[model samples]
Target: MNERLLLDHLLVRGPASRADLAKITGLSKPTVSAALAGMEDSGLVHLAGEVLGRPGPVTSLYDVTAGAAHIGAVDIGRDWIRVAVADLRGRFVGRKDGRNAAKNSEDLVSRVRELAQAAAGQAGLPWTSVITAVVGSPGVYDKDADRMIFAPNLPGWEGSGLGDRLRTALGVDVTIENDINLAALGEHAYGAGHGIANFALVSIGTGVGMGIVVNGELYVGARGAAGEVSFLPAPEPVPADDDTLRHGLTESLAAAPGVVRAARAAGLHLDTAKEVFTAAAEGDPAALEVVHAEGRRIGGLIVAVASVLDPELVVLTGGVGHNLALLGDAITSRFAELGPLRPRVVASTLGDSGVLLGAVARALSQAWDHIFDLRQSGVQPRQSGVQYGMSR
Candidate 1:
């Protein structure tokens, strides 16, 4: 109990001397010293440095041994795959990014494995040395079915045994979560949503999705699909087709592809949403019109979210949604036309790293829990061969 308490304090508050730990934890100096000594021997805490030039004897500052264990974070997207290796302190020591030109889900899994190994190698460690890994992808993971669902953007992603393949490919215990949900967590931890108790992250790019944070906690619905807002009906008419049904009305009409489709219809010879946004930035009338229409669609979506969630802020992210400067006016206009409710909206500052950072944060939590569990059971975590989330 003493060691765990001291370690927890160190992890949360950074390095501390014995006297400081004792005073903060309400324990005697001797007790604090004993706990520090025990944790130091177990390779969980270390004397990081010494406070010099003090009025009395030198004070030894102790901290959690951040490099004692490592965790992996993977962000799997339609166009890219990102992997990061982070220490116990949630600091990325190594990272690798690669284009995701996967022809199928199996190829995607293999690509993720390659990137994971490369990232681990950059940190001077083998991939197997990572204790836990969290994978952020486009859809909610169905635990009972052991597959992903509602991820039409990524072809073959909803197939059966997808989770098993990821675990096998990575050779580690993996936790799969919705990428947008992770982005919300990332913003809360390190971006625009920081210090906000309640907010929502709505991503509009290849697909549209929302992640809800209520009372500073991620709120996934009963089926882990709390913020799947893409299925919401749009104000404009939607064609009844297989593609439209697969991606839902709102997504089909508001996402990047929708922006491109609208641009093409407006006589703008743009192939990608990026090109349309670029053209709009360069003062192209046709492109600007398309962007404004897309923004209005997003505005309606935000109004819907605000009616139900009433979040403190809504963070806009993803390839297309991050263009807040271009979309702000139209979004505000549509908000006024829709209703009297006005929700705070901001662009995500974390950019492409939001999901990856959130994955690292979650993996760190899991690593800490697993390490302490082993310690409580009288097993040295460094010597324990059991992987995280696995039965001993």
Candidate 2:
């Protein structure tokens, strides 16, 4: 208990003297002194010189030694793979980004391993040093089947023994989470949703999905598929046989291909959502019309989410969703027309960093749990805790 208190104080207050720790933690001076002695002897903390301020004799200051151990995080997208290694404090020590050129599950697995190794090496550590790793993936991970489901963007990802392959390659317990879920968690932990108890993140890009946070926790329903909003019905019934419908009905209309389709049908002849947005920015009538249509569709989906969950805030993200300068007003206008209970809709501040940051947050949480368990069980800690960059 004393150890945990001291560590928690140091984590929140940075390096502190024994007197400061005692005062902050409400512990006796001898207790703080004893705890610090044990912690320093265990290599969990180190002297950082003396604390200055108050009038008494200078008191020694100590801080968590950050180089004790590390964790890893990966964001696996259809076009890119990003990997990062962070110390126990959750500060990223090394990072690597690579294109996803793999044609099959085996190739993808190998690529992830390669990227993880590269990140670990850059952190001056071996692969085995990564205590835990979390991977942010594009679909719902069915743990019972150990495969990814609902991942039309990634063919053959389901039932591909990906979980086992990742475990074998990394030699550590690997956690796979839906990318959108990670994004919501990221926003809650670090970005727009910070301190907000209830919020939803709707991501519209190559696909459409949402991550819901209710009362300070992620609401992943049964089968880990609660946020799969792609199947929601839209005004224009996308043909069931349409290839884009593979992801879902709403997705086919609110996502990138849908945007491109709208642009082309409007005589714009655009090839990508980026082009559509660019054209819209230039006041192209066709492109603007398409974007307005998509905003209404996306707004309808958000209304559905609000009517049901009524989150405190709604965050828009992804290649198309983050185009707030172009789509924000349209979405708000449509929402106003549709309902009386509209939450504030905003764009993600983290941009593309949400998924990877969320992964690292989870990894750090897991690693710290392991360390705390070891400490409670009387096991000498490999390394203690520290407050890294970007406070969690």
Candidate 3:
């Protein structure tokens, strides 16, 4: 029913000849020619050359122009606000970072505008050239309510319309999502989950989060809060300890803050999670024990994920995930002990840019639809080829 989807269906199936495009989309040859011509003239698509099978002149091949549009991706983490300028092809042309999003959404909006303006200048385009912006946050962002529902870790973000603020400041539409959702989609599109049937992206950072992709699509559970693993209860040594109850149950115990607390009790003056990890690398026995224990705890967590979803692999990302060498074998040995049923664990391929790239990818996907929709003829249905086999 939707022509835009039809055109995209053709574009995704690989470059097609005009006749083949018509055949694939069930559009008349003349209609296909008109659509292709319109798209090429607008600079949204270009000719890639021709086919030898056709008699007379070679047919022209068409491809979507990547630079014709762009998306601004922003990641508002605890310490820094990372922004990236990326084209439709998901290539990041520029990047910039500023202070954290803080308690106030207004400050974040201003910073985003400044960075978006800078990124557009860097890309040799105007702000309007950016189709949309995606902001990834640690909190639960309620899209319809236009508010960040439950983010105690972020002080001034409770009743903010982050999307509206950024859209207003930058003069472009904006979308906000859980940072893990962005990272999960990123891994699925360009990282370890590329072509994998089932995969999970687990990030160990200032907090723990996860993004899940099942059957080749991101699984965003109801209420957009699917992968909130940080609050899942962990086993506590002292059953009746109120302080232990506040620290989180299970998954939170191995997060960055949790690791710091564990190290400090063992006499390490660690100001950040990085220090705790560094101590472990240098064979500080207390730090080593704390980190390795965390690793085993993480492994147990993985067992739950694997058993529930049975993803093909689990990708670990962020500062803590990248330092798997120091976290000890408790994770690997424990997971391995789960036998083949335990999903294989590997480090994230995208490093810190995983969420940034993902936000860019989401923006690009949205823009791709817009670009194709404007071309009009891309939507008309075309015919399909039939192959004859040995008939019974």
User: What is the per-residue lDDT of model 1 for residues 12-110, given as tens digits with 9 covering 90 to 100?
Assistant: 899999999999999999999888887787788898999999899999999998888889999999899999999988899999999999888998999
Candidate 1 residue spans exceeding 4 A from truth: 381-392
Question: lDDT tens digits, residues 1-392, model 3?
Answer: 33353347545675667777777777888877776775666565677767778678877777766676678898878777888888766788778777775556677667778877887777777766677788888867887778875455565676656667766897766788889889988888888888897989888887778899888887888897777776676744634365444434553577777778888888988987888888888888988888887888788778878878888889988777777777538787777777666677888878888889889878877776655544453332112121111010
By lDDT rank, best first, the candidates go 1, 2, 3
Clashes of 1: 0
Q: List the pairs of residues colliding in candidate 2.
A: none
Q: Model 3 Cα displacement at 351 (Å)?
A: 0.8
Higher-lDDT candidate among 2 and 3? 2
Q: Clash pairs of candidate 1?
A: none
Scored by TM-score, the top model is 1
Q: What TM-scores do the predictions have?
A: 0.96, 0.93, 0.84
Provide the lowest-lDDT 10-residue window in model 1: 383-392
Local error of candidate 3 at residue 130 (angstroms):
0.9
Report the lDDT of model 1 for residue 104: 87
**Number of colliding residue pairs in model 2:** 0
RMSD of each: 1.9, 3.8, 8.1
Q: Per-residue lDDT of 163-273 in model 2, one digit per residue for the tens? A: 999999887779999999998998988899999999999999888889999999888998899989998887786778867566888888889988998888888877899
**lDDT (CA) per prediction:** 0.90, 0.84, 0.74
